[model samples]
Target: MAVITKYVVERSGVEKMTFTSKAEADAYDKMLDTADALQVLLSASNQLTDEAQAEALALYLAQQKEPLLVALGVKKAAKAGKQDSEEQTTAKQDDTSSKGLKAVAAGHAA
Candidate 1:
């Protein structure tokens, strides 16, 4: 008799499917890891119930049509852009304030 090794996938506490190959199983497991990471990131907490974490993971997996890794790159770019914009705004405000201070000092000197 030939022994077969299979991987089981469970969803919501129920058995969902099985994979015949280790690579396939590893891929699914990695997806779950990504979901868990995302949940922690979005909630800023690691104390979520199993159901809540699973829900978040499922939602993330479903929302992405492409690979999840690609979305992370896009998110990083967007965050960097936002930071740059905020820095520009703060610099402008500082410049305006310094100019106002200079004008006040000149008036007092007159």
Candidate 2:
């Protein structure tokens, strides 16, 4: 009998790619994870179109700044036909408010 190890990759909880080597899979996964983090900020901004946000995020990564640290909640996949754009927009605002509060608290402590 032979045993095989496969490197499965995912982004935003959806499988994206697969690799034969752990190093390759991990590298790609890390990049995707970073992009996901950036997307949260981009999504909340509502200023840039999706395309522009992606480009801006890539530029930021190219500069090699320390990655933004955000504590994310485990969100269930929205039920079909239950969530619409309006709800999504409101949720984004709520998320931004929480993040802002965290920043203010940190500032007060410092």
Candidate 3:
């Protein structure tokens, strides 16, 4: 028998998302919180009259906060670009390394 544990992020007593990792669940909750805060701030401006549009904008802004900060001069674009390249290199390395390991395991199993 096997048991699996799931992390759920709830908003207003409703399950909004479920994740197999706690880190992802927590990050999602933080994003949701940021969106809620941004929505309130945008509502105060009164520029976006439609509530749905305001909410949508808030979520978008929250999700793209890194790029938003860079565009607003609050973050360095160079740093973001470096991080992206590093992540891509790491992903490529993992894919290549796992391929050889999988082949070795398969040969031993056969």
Candidate 4:
């Protein structure tokens, strides 16, 4: 059997994690240390209120913003384009049927 180790991120005395290897444990420890440092900096900076800490923590977890925004923008544009195409197709069908009815009416009048 292999020994499984754990790494924890402690904030306000709460710790949580699991690591399969020493390297993974070390990496997690480093991440936790960095997070602690960032929290200290944030507190010192006076940039976040108590209510804003969660958002700050989330930003730390993700590490960067540009890539996230790009991904979200791509998904939003794709969704909008699909909706536009569906609406256009429905409008075209409606117009075709309306024109066909007009043609049939004209033939009957003649």
Q: What are the per-model numbers of colliding residue pairs?
A: 0, 0, 0, 0
Residue 90 in candidate 2, Cα distance off native in Å: 59
Candidate 2 lDDT by residue in tens digits, 15-103: 87888899999878777666667666676777767767675775466334332221122343345224676688899999999999999
Question: What TM-score do all the candidates reach, one by one?
Answer: 0.40, 0.39, 0.70, 0.40
Candidate 4 clash total?
A: 0
Tens digits of per-residue lDDT, candidate 4, 6-82, equal: 55545577765665577876766676666566667667766676837844674475453334445767344556778
RMSD of 1: 15.1
Off by over 4 Å in 2: 1-4, 49-110
Candidate 2: worst-modelled 10 consecutive residues by lDDT: 65-74
lDDT of 1 by residue, 1-110 (tens): 99999899776798756899889877776776666666656565545557676566656764462545456564445567789999999999999999999999999999
Residue 58 error for model 2, in Å? Answer: 5.8
Q: Which runs of model 1 end up more than 4 angstroms from their true locations?
A: 9-17, 45-54, 57-59, 62-110
Lowest summed lDDT window (length 10), candidate 3: 73-82
lDDT of 3 by residue, 1-110 (tens): 99999999999899999999999999999999999999999999999999999999999999998888889988789777799999999999999999989999999999
Best by lDDT: 3
* Error in Å for residue 37 of model 2: 1.1
CA displacement after TM-score superposition, residue 19 of candidate 1 (Å) = 1.3
